[model samples]
Target: MNGNRNSQDVVVACSRGITPGMPSFAEQIAKSAPDAADIKQRRWIYIPYDRYTDRTGPLTEQSAAATGVVIVESTAKALRRPYHKKKLVVLISNMRHFALEQAARGVSVLYVFSPKSHGQALVDVQREHALPELTCMTPAERELRLDLATAIENGLQMKFAEDTTWASRTADFTEVYGTYKPGKSYVMDRFYRKARQKTGILMQNGKPVGGQFSFDADNRNPYKNQIPVPKPPKFRPDPITEEVIAFVGETYAQHFGEIDGFDLPCTQADCDLMWRFALEHLLPHFGPFEDAMRDDHGQLFHSKTSVLLNLGRLLALDLVRDVAQAAEAGAIPLASAEGFIRQLLGWREFMRHLHGETDGYRLLAGHVPQEHRRFTQEVSPDRTEEATKAYASAISKADPYAGARPSALGASLPLPAVYWGVKSGLHCMDTVVAQVIQEGWSHHITRLMVLSNLANLCGFSPRELTDWFWFAYVDAYDWVVEPNVLGMATYADGGLTATKPYVSGAAYINRMSNFCGHCQYDPKKSTGPGSCPFTSLYWTFLERNQDILAGNFRLQMPYNTLRKKPAQELMQLRARAEEAIAHLQSFKRPAY
Candidate 1:
């Protein structure tokens, strides 16, 4: 009903960021065609997915007769690698609900189930439906972009337009950071400030409202049970979503994570509940305790809108706009609003553009030497040969900087079974892993501070850890996970994505969470049998990589401490670190 169509071209909605009322992805395709008649008669918009959800960009249309929309469920993608059960349910249910919603809106929808790859499946849809030419937004993932390109080369006529889901684009990154060179690190704060100036989100008369661009200093306080934590909003599954849960539980039963409490919003109507809950219940206290974690509460004060945003149910710009309005009206603190906005406008966009700048997956293995990288075969047995080959092709051979000097901090250990739900005696490790297993989610701090930090200190391979994060979390995608895992968390990129390593001792964890109180290990003892593994390994990490890290200005204090340590004491610390690594390794389970 949006516009008239006679079917010269069909729009394809790759459902990573497909929501209504946005501009069409075929505008350029329509404009480029010299015949105005050819551009005027568009009748169908085809929406596609594989393994329920895979694409990271959306095809939008404000005016078009989307008489038909296509949704593809590719079994090849599902079996390509074992994914978290909750992740599968979230994706499949959302896609199904989207299709039904479109059908209700009077659009003819074609839902396809195929055993082939995503591109081949799309080609099949185009031929089966007799669609003349397919047009879509450029995908956020490089692999998917290449997949579609291959389909195009193989005779599937498709035109691509820019994706509108992000607040910024490749040009935006270049506008602020200049043309990206391989192995160069871009500071996020600079990009964030520039973004704030351009968007005018928290600005008053060409200046930031609070006289600061970031409230990160005020956002790092530990939770002290000051306010009663609110329970997350749960939407009972409708029959459509229930069917998806049943399908995932029956089909991917062996996949990691539990599907019992599947409460994510699958429809546009339900997305508001989460937004309301976040503003009313979670936003007030979200800033101070943003970094805090508790064993009892899985999500303390975080909004968890990443899944919704990543799923295309909500728009990033809309969320930040509303948040800024709320802050202006005194509904929330300025610090809280700024903190939330910084994540989307700052970190999220930074990660995406950085992923593009560094050439996506190639960033993981290119800088690290061959001997230091962890291939998919060495990390987990669950990935199919096709998946492994695809992964190897993405990272190993296509890297533009494959000959770069290997980082001194690169690790080669098989990802410890501890990451796959094997119990590490440390309460922090167990608590975070249990959260991931149950919900396939944890806040950013838990991800950076606990899970990834332990992996780094334990010397687990960064590539293996990166892959584990991709399959383990609901919000994870290659475009987001690689920068976070390889660049920021593990510092395996030789300081290209992060200024310094994120490693820390038990003291940071103890100050941040209640995990240490319930832990069997003593946080104070670095060498004794009961010493905390994080504390012991942290010192050893410093000693092992001092020569490389000593030159880093940000790491000067730690390096100074390591240099001043007595010879015998440092030797004992190394012995304790070895013991801790052995203890952690003993709990290794086969990767899921």
Candidate 2:
């Protein structure tokens, strides 16, 4: 898998970002055991819109062997879908810096600004250079993979090198659990423990450190403004980044997020500084406050490295290794270290494998009958041609399945305007959306508990919510958001990714944060005009889904409590829940 197919004039096509420390597949191909004379020269190509990595292998060999390197920046690809302006800036700027760094190593680097798809760009490069064959790491996305397959059909002789970006490989997932079956539930804890055993991370004498595999229970202390939340260190834009910011600002002016004060890491040096800041100032407190949300402080102790990690600026396993060492050296708590590692090795890896196993849940989407389908939404009439094409091709195809199980509670409502910028009376919902509008990022808790939770309660389409996450978040990719949103967040997969829907009542929100204090609605009330929307909706959700959820072992207490409610009171709560949904859908301030 590491070696390349035999070719005298093979062009190595690199992805968007390549880790300096890690040997890319192109580098591996360069070092493959081939006669020096038979391999005349190697050409390299880079497409910046592709997706993540770091390892210590054959970097010098690849750079020295390459005759030329082409880094293509596709404006058309950037315009293909609605993305947060900040996300585009980060990706394009990082790509630009990466190209300059590669060129500095004495390689003949050609930077191209293309207004075409990646496949077309690569084909053009091959034809221009007279390269006989093309090779690239298997793309991380389905659409891109399909595009490449089409290019191959159109006379581009290409070979796909194995994708080695993730902490856990596809084989590792298969080893843990045999080939994934539809409707089969996979437990994250089991996979996390097995991964720990395989990697020996945070382990001593063949057992987990701190005498356990997870410290998740200890990592959920809600923030009460008691600890000083460190401001994320800013990386001032260099001239290259400044140019990219200006370009993205004007070109993507209609995009979702803000571009002013763009301070994300655009180079390996900036990424290093950000990592160091997390180690010194953020990791120690990250565990307890990992689940906490604050209105004033959007990212409390969270290491906002997902953007960098996904962009191949930082490696997931590398971070996990460093965190374990830090914990062992007493630089951070075991809970904090374990909590962070769980994300990289457990959730991130699990999501990737599951996404592939399920064909990005497209199989489930394809199964839904047309008459019952509400998942597909039309592209907005005002969108640009590229954006419209992207939305129509992606969204309309995501037709959610109507599973045989009652637990697959059908949620068919369209995503509300509140998600886009309209006012919702709920303080938590409005506050999180405001942050997403500005930064295109929020901690995972806010995503699950506030955004996805409310959407589920209000019966919003899972596909719509999933696409929104894909476009709106800086850290989101299709592989990451599909499992997280459809399975864990909304339970659209019917216990495939998670055992139960991560829904909560207003009490949980009030217990976790101060949002309820600022709202006019009563968190304790489950009925009437002044009742908190979440509180009212919580009971109604239980009542409505009772047929599906009553048999679940985890819902015994909630169902028992629901059964105790008087019939008249239940009717009133349902009416209030409907009123709350209407209030949210109104796209104006609540008429208090």
| Residue 463, model 1: Cα distance from true site in angstroms | 0.5
Q: Per-residue lDDT tens digits of candidate 1, residues 107-142?
A: 445566554556777887777656667656566666
- Global lDDT for candidate 2? 0.72
Residue 269, model 2, lDDT: 82
Cα shift from native, residue 63, model 2 (Å):
3.5
Give the clashing residue pairs of candidate 2, or none: 22-55
Each prediction's TM-score against the native? 0.87, 0.87
> Which parts of model 2 have CA positions greater than 4 angstroms off?
1-40, 45-61, 65-67, 365-407, 588-592
**Residue pairs in clash, model 1:** 47-70, 417-588, 417-589
Which lDDT tens digits does candidate 2 get at residues 49-76? 4442223222232654463445556554
Residue 502 alpha-carbon offset, candidate 1, angstroms: 0.9
